[model samples]
Target: MKLNTNKAVLKPGMTLIELTIVILVLITLISVLFIGAKAYKEGADNATCILNQEQVQKAVRSHQNMNAKNDTESFPHDEVFGATGIISEPTEPTEPDNLYAGMQDDVYPVVGTAYISCTTTNGNGPHAPASTEGW
Candidate 1:
């Protein structure tokens, strides 16, 4: 019965080919994960930018209603941001972190009840929704 005990021995470490294959597989998986994460982050940023635009629009309407302003009248950046208690500090759509880019930092004028649009011209990042002219 003990005759076949030493017939085969298990190796402690993987061979070079096995190691290479494993490394390759790991690299592929990691790259896929990174790509998926990037897409997900971009989608999230776009959604957030859209939501911010909607909120700003609502604030503008509220301000206009409260003050009896008309759609033809445009308001300053600070009207909705500081004067009203809606958004204390608006987020600027900057580069790298912001997929919806090209927002001015100091100014976010409420104009004619239209949605706030991102002026990014790169054609790579998120764009404003065509239906409402904003993200």
Candidate 2:
């Protein structure tokens, strides 16, 4: 008796529909993963921004402590303006890449006022100068 390799090898274990279904499932899974990953990245960026704001706050406190004549007083508003040594230069994580949006940028900040009187653009970009209030 001859071997029946041809009989079994020629048999199609999966139909065209089965192959198509498997491909579709894989595509769906990949798309979902990409979306989930994108969201995770966004969350991470926001968290980083919050932490940076906190660091700026600490730096400001340090400056105040070093310069305050009395413990009850804080750094004068004029002294705080245009000072760079106390804190690192703030920058945004995304777009514009500069600290300010533009030469004539106009934004209003409320959340991160305590540290630097600046907030991320639309609460998404990095904290920057919104007004000359905090320092």
Candidate 3:
């Protein structure tokens, strides 16, 4: 009988090409997931900023109600709400210690028509209107 010794067998380990492909796919998937998560975080941050601005608007209206008779001509810069009160300046230079401290800086402009300003780290001024009128 002729010797029948030759046989094909599958390898136990992945081939280099197969391993490379798997690594590439994993990298692509991870990148996509990371980008999606980052976008979600940014959107959440923007929503928080808007909520904060609305609170500031409420404080302004309260101040306006208190000083209706006075010819104040402009919203109080230093003491409409109060010198130490919330809503004194827009965009506190530093991160606030608490929510109230943060609101303290959401002040309306003393001069020309003031609106809720939504700004990024950079100095771009895009305003978001308040939920109610005269914000």
Candidate 4:
């Protein structure tokens, strides 16, 4: 009587093709996550820029209220209101340049007139201009 011991008949798990497919799926998921994170960061930066603008606007209003009698000629420039040093001073001039230039360039124009311009840095990208309209 001979005993049967043929273990080779059993099939193995997970073929190379299946493993490759799983790896590809994982890579795709990671790519999507990275893209989402980047978008979120940009949005947050935009919000922050807007908030800064609002603060400057409020300060301008306060200044105006304090000197309403001379409102017509009481336009605050960089020197008076320290526009250059509002949030942070820009390396370049914070004049009427590209919108994002001020933020990225590290400049902030005066915020006394009806309209003011604020800019963002290159970190925000071309879409995110360094300058913006203020009240």
Q: Better model by lDDT, 1 or 2?
A: 1
The residue pairs found clashing in candidate 2 are none
Worst 10 residues of 2 by lDDT: 100-109
lDDT of 4 by residue, 31-75 (tens): 999999987876766665555555555555555556553444445
Runs in model 3 deviating more than 4 A are 1-11, 69-72, 80-83, 87-114, 121-135
Candidate RMSDs in Å, in order, are 5.7, 7.6, 6.0, 7.1
lDDT of 2 by residue, 1-135 (tens): 877665545655898999999999999999999988887776665665555555655555566567644333434443433464655555655442655222121122233354433345443455433333443
The whole-model lDDT of each prediction reads 0.58, 0.52, 0.55, 0.50
Clashes of each: 0, 0, 2, 19
Pairs of residues at least 3 apart in sequence or in different chains that clash in candidate 1: none
Which is better, 1 or 3, measured by lDDT? 1
TM-score computed on alpha carbons, candidate 4: 0.55
- Give per-model TM-scores: 0.66, 0.58, 0.58, 0.55
| Residue-level error in angstroms, candidate 4, position 5 | 6.3
lDDT of 3 by residue, 46-135 (tens): 566666666666666667667663323455445644467655544522234323333334344442333345544322233343344445
TM-score of 1: 0.66
Maximum-TM-score candidate: 1
* TM-score of candidate 2 versus the correct structure, residues matched by position: 0.58
Question: Over the stretch 4-92, how does candidate 1's per-residue lDDT look in tens digits?
Answer: 65658777998999999999999999999998887776666666656666676666667667878766565565766765565654463
